[model samples]
Target chain A: METIVLGIGETLVRDDRHWASWANWLGVPAHTLSALVGAAVAQGRDATDALRVLRPGMDVDEAYLARAAAGRGEHLDESDLYPDVRPALAELRAAGIRVVVAGNGTVRAGERLRALDLPADLVVTSDEWGVRKPDPAFFARVVEVSGAKPGATLYVGDHPADDLFPAAAAGLRTAHLRRGPYGHWWAEHPDVVGTADFRVNALPELVGVVGGSPARPGAEPHSARPAFEDGTGAVGGARPARVSYLRGL
Target chain B: METIVLGIGETLVRDDRHWASWANWLGVPAHTLSALVGAAVAQGRDATDALRVLRPGMDVDEAYLARAAAGRGEHLDESDLYPDVRPALAELRAAGIRVVVAGNGTVRAGERLRALDLPADLVVTSDEWGVRKPDPAFFARVVEVSGAKPGATLYVGDHPADDLFPAAAAGLRTAHLRRGPYGHWWAEHPDVVGTADFRVNALPELVGVVGGSPARPGAEPHSARPAFEDGTGAVGGARPARVSYLRGL
Candidate 1:
């Protein structure tokens, strides 16, 4: 049997305006953070500054801040997520996957995930692990926890530096969610295995990368290969066992 | 001197794909078009076979011809555009501010404008049309066309029909590019001003929506009334003409 794949990220509850969660203030459509981020990126700014410019008028959650402080390093907080992501998470977990939350402020992210009432095999916080992604040791934690080899695991995420690069460096196959309106530096990254817009909007899509899934109701499984691969190489092939924790969604 | 806006579209430049143009083909970032189209709207078919899903060995482009031909009736030919676009032709001859081709198909989109090359003010094409924004008309074509009726002229494009409907139908303002991506059916009628997006991409963006030299770059003599009521319920004030046609990267 193949080892299961997992996902990690905050499950903020809200609408597109949820970017304002940190400030506790909502902006109109014309001034939403996504729009600002898009404008700033179009003007050629880096991600950190782009995030700064895109700051919401809201305040950061106390729990989110505490988790970041405990990590003792430069990292974004849990408030980064848009709301309404829990359903996506629950669906993945019910499919019997191992989910390891790895951000510094991930406790807040985890709380939100649990609030959504999803099941997971594991939830790893960088505060407890003392290591974060882009650091192979962080992934090593995944190997240690899940009993899966580095090459056998596939990491799927939206961040390029923190998620994709390190995942690739560690020899694990990687797929990028490419969520939100803006594309990241990893958009051009060669190792990006696949991309999903809104349809295959969750981590299970990568299951197809490791091994194609059986068709679901009203939905056909997609191949894990890159959409543009012109016979250069094939991606992951191990069919990980489904984690039943995510099936309800 | 009111600024001029030129809207352009591709009547035809075959690309053997179910989609209409290269920018759209490129903009989609290589994914399953069928999956992107979503199942709720896909009826109960076991599979959707757009250009994105040809088998690994098949010539993907060739595989889409049958499907594309089936939808060809929904498209308008290049000759059909010249009539409604006449006002823009006159503006170009008068050496107005800029010519904006909002949809994709940039390569062929400019052919119509450049063929005349009648001392154009500027050019904006979807390839370089800045954000390919669904609104602001990529600079409001009808306002540019009528010259004296900025408030009365209706603007139209294919996508985002809802966002544009209120302004046009209420006699406030209007524009319609076409009908598919942004403005699916279930949207209200001629509330749309005119239809474009002839091939798929925002043609105006391809031809020249953002750059080239202004008709008179530095000295923009504002000799016109406000284009609209600013929709802010504010009284009269001189609304500065947007410097959309100036050269940009």
Candidate 2:
């Protein structure tokens, strides 16, 4: 089966502004907070590192941090998706593609995913795995959990170094979701942009990039290899068994 | 009238690869040629300037250049538009919006427009105007030709300084079409991205950004000030005469 492992967080949710909002709430300069968060993300560090760096000398409050994280979660749950996200995810799922959300997201993001009822087979976050992206082990774990060979898998994300390069290095087809903070950063480097197998602005455009899903009724035929068999042993030959797991990575 | 002036070249067609193809045909490195072309475009120069730079010391063959240009035109004529472009243009025109194509494109591009029979009230090009975008007079000419008040018009383009900044400076609502070479470049700078009233990845998303055409059946109501007065006379009390231009700008 063709598995698509998406680096969720900002790829699916509008989480870039969360850092700025949290900074504003905590009386920190938004730009300073954004830069610190950006630096942490670029280094493949977790959100905790960002918080620690932003509040170095201050008495950090765990409960207040939890509340702030929850606030970000609520913001995400309140329909903060890009316009093409919902329909594209629906179409991909309906077409029988195994969609997974793998990222360096906070625990609250996973909670928000459940609250929003997002469609995906598995969601693996750094909070659960203790390893963030740009780490080869993280992508390997995602491929293993998704039951897809790196060659057959498609890993979509916004970051060039943190997401695209590492995923590409791991042998998965990489797509650059050009929208968020990292996306803007990636755009500046032509060499990085050239590395992505596909660079799309909207999520729905992936339907065209990945080829149309066969299970979608009345969907136009695409040049992409079929995701599954047509039962007559013509197109894909045979339908692969569905891979499912209930535990976090 | 609400006029939408689109930066036609790559915004409406796929013209990037053609440059590389032409460069290869002329025995020049694609990257070197691309950089030279980019430099010219960054200064708001036209296709002719790019050509002059590309073939600086060469024995220029006018016939060969014309044939190559025509080849590019034919490539464009073969439905080289983005997936969302056609439907979006049709819907906008059906809604009685005056659409115009304004850009720093070659004369062959204008011919391709005629061949494709694209829906537009006027088609303007640097080839005809003797000036390119980011030049205040070029935008002024567009405003004068379209009979559109700058505030009421929407200028959609892919470039930051070349397209978005100049149009915005002229007091037009600007939309950054986040595709093509310049789109990727513009996304890198937050300051430039912030200048655009709308930053869209897909052309169909414009139906949402620009209020959906009232003529489209089952269109949702939007909060934008109505482009024209309704019979109820509550919003936009009096309807203005539609500006119709039969000739090219």
TM-score of chain A of each: 0.56, 0.71
- Alpha carbon lDDT of residue B97, candidate 1? 39
TM-score of 2: 0.40
Clashing pairs in 2: none
Q: Mind giving the per-residue lDDT tens digits that candidate 2 earns over A1-249?
A: 377888775687665356546665655433334434443443345444545653544444563566557764224555566556778888778877788888986676667665766777787687678788879989888878777677667788877767877787787877777655455434434444345655666677676656533322234334332222333323222222211100100
- Over A131-210, each residue of candidate 1 has an lDDT whose tens digit, in order, gives 76557788777667755665555565655445655665665545555543222322433333332211223444554544
lDDT of each: 0.36, 0.59
Q: Which predicted model would earn the best lDDT? A: 2
- For every prediction, compared with the true complex, DockQ reads 0.03, 0.02
Q: Name the 10 consecutive residues with the lowest summed lDDT in model 2 chain A.
A: A240-249
